[model samples]
Target: MVRPDGSIRVGTATVAGVLAGTVLAGCGTVGGSPAGKETSSTREQDTKAVRSAYGKTAEQDTARVTLRVQTSADGTSMTASGRGTVDLRDGDSVMTLSAQGGRVEQRVVDQVLYQKLPRSEVPGGKPWIRIDLQKAAERRAVGGQSVNDPVQAAAFARAIDGKDVTREGTSEVGEVNTTHYRVAVDVAELPDGATLRRQLGPTLPMDVWLDGDGRIRRQQIDMTLKAPAEDAATDRASSPPRPAKVRTVMEFSDFGTDVEAKAPPPRQVTDLTGTALERGQTQN
Candidate 1:
């Protein structure tokens, strides 16, 4: 079995390369309105329409959604793809994701369990590991349930209450026509630890686009962070070193809403170290 670090190296390269190629080939230049052009009334109508379409009482039946996720870690320069499914009703939802590459596969059931180990590491050579997704989901969902930013949520709600909405414009995303909206919020009002703080400056700049029914089609956000100056002195003193920048992208479709997804039976997690131990005992 490959060493954990070695496996990570191989998997990262494969996933990152695939993501780069796809993004370049499929995501052509996005052309649309620049900032400061959209009218307030237009934005309001778009937000209202989306909220009305998705907002439901807690007792409402759940709607199933399958989304593709592509992630690139900045330090590792590796990209990976995963499939996520959400069953949402009212404000509650269940999310699951599965990602695989090389001799490794990982599954997160209901955003709770997170298990990853080598495929060849299992006792019987099973190529996957089981994790507890329920615990993981709860830890990550402490803030709220919606996928969008909390600030945006509050801004949207206030806009609806104040009868003000800003329509940014229209753009095409993969042949789908999407309407854009710019919901206003003060920079100081943003929640701490928001993605904006991680990506750009303290202020959060965002653009949200929705389909005709108010389903979020896409979102762009900008923020910043501080790091040691990249001078020679800083480099020599850096202990862990920085990771590479790689991005992954994934897409999912045709989720069978009627056919519910069932979790696999309980099993032990597997890894390269475990496989070595099992093989040694077998030799006796």
Candidate 2:
């Protein structure tokens, strides 16, 4: 099947739209001052200029995001890559995640998400699964699970809110020369669903890039995990805590443009509410 974005669906899953791997949940204000040399804009003023650009980008009608993510810790490593679009006005989105041999895609509308899992993850041979975000939030999947949704898109810039930010000069993103900013995010300040307690614990490192129009151009988020200290009662504090790093990169383009995404065919879609909802809860 050909999706509105002009991508063909493979297998039973309907194909559409497409990520760095991280769906935005919480974004904030910035900290610090401009780096490099003195210029026409004061360091503090440059920081605000950078923040202003992101502020405007967040208010656009849509964002086309390409993403790559790599996570490593505890001697294991995992990598995920995808592409997707977010409707800034409504939090609706479509994404195609990586799967063996083919791609598993999903669409979000009216707080309901319709998705096609990898064939290996399909239940009872069903090609598509529908999930209600309102319900999913009840099950502890609140933060990042809703990244594809617009609510997070609106809130993403909040990551730099009230924090010190510094200009890192200019860098090219998606071939566009962008002004770069370095930001530090306290775990407590992150948006509700984008908290790093489970990933980074204390703080998360982040980067933001903006183009001339003050729109977001790219982002980099660094998260690290540490293995828990062994139980003193059970045995010696051996193994201490092994640290792992996760890198997430997101590039944005096509701001304010309409995304070509539509609902999958009805026959191919299944609801995740009721008993089906219980059987397929996306979280615990």
Candidate 3:
């Protein structure tokens, strides 16, 4: 679909756009101190434990994910859902997203994104559009935020272990027992956090649930955003922002699951790398 810049970005960039848009939906408020006070040493221990668990989870290499995103802007609201599996190491992934009564499937392999669209919407009647993320990067057409990297998305929980991470006790998520935590995600550490921080703020509140093994079971972010201006080519300075609110939740399962991704048959593909770059479209 077309971005605010009037350019198309399919696959991970599209998902990233929606997700990044979700997180950037609004500025964050100062977090209230957690209910229980902790000694500095205890906080350090908890943070270390959480970070270690995230590291262990990342080493698992793959997982299945289900997500929901809801956004409200200009007095209008919408919701979208997605299901996918991703290779945490290679960044290969396959995902399907549903929104407004439509579904779209996407696959990423060898740093290329393949999107399946209605035949009428694609050139040459090809049902799939191929965009080379590597080519896009080479042309500086992507913001290098790792937003399109499934690996990055999977490791997003790592942002929760900042100094302020608070253990909120234990709870059940699905059939698993998990420890609940709350923190202001450290945007500075995220690959694209600097940009997000500039657009939204330095931190965003997040709630996470971790299984005993330290793997994330569920995570949520609720934010209010100053929506970027609609002019496709205008910079933030030239366009007034819109007020909006967004919330996103994601759950993980089947860690280390096998995730397969293959490039679409060339005959059914329309390469859009050149056109996307020519339009000066950049994804964050």
Off by over 4 Å in 3: 1-15, 18-34, 134-150, 153-162, 223-240, 278-284
**Which candidate order results from sorting by lDDT in descending order?**
3, 2, 1
Per-residue lDDT tens digits for candidate 2, residues 41-91, read 555565566556644765787777665556676678665555777665555
What TM-score would each prediction reach against the true structure? Answer: 0.49, 0.69, 0.75
lDDT per residue (tens digit) for residues 185-277 in model 3: 676766656666665577777776778887777766666654444543464666454666666666668887878788889999988878767
* Candidate order (TM-score): 3, 2, 1
Model 2 misplacement above 4 A: 1-41, 99-102, 142-163, 193-199, 226-244, 265-267, 272-284
How many clashes show up in model 3?
Answer: 4
Highest lDDT against the true fold, candidate: 3
lDDT agreement of model 2 with the native = 0.54
Quote the positional error of residue 229 for candidate 3 in Å.
7.7
lDDT of 1 by residue, 144-236 (tens): 112232213443343242223355557665455666654443343444435423423343334445655455444432222233235334566
Highest TM-score scorer: 3
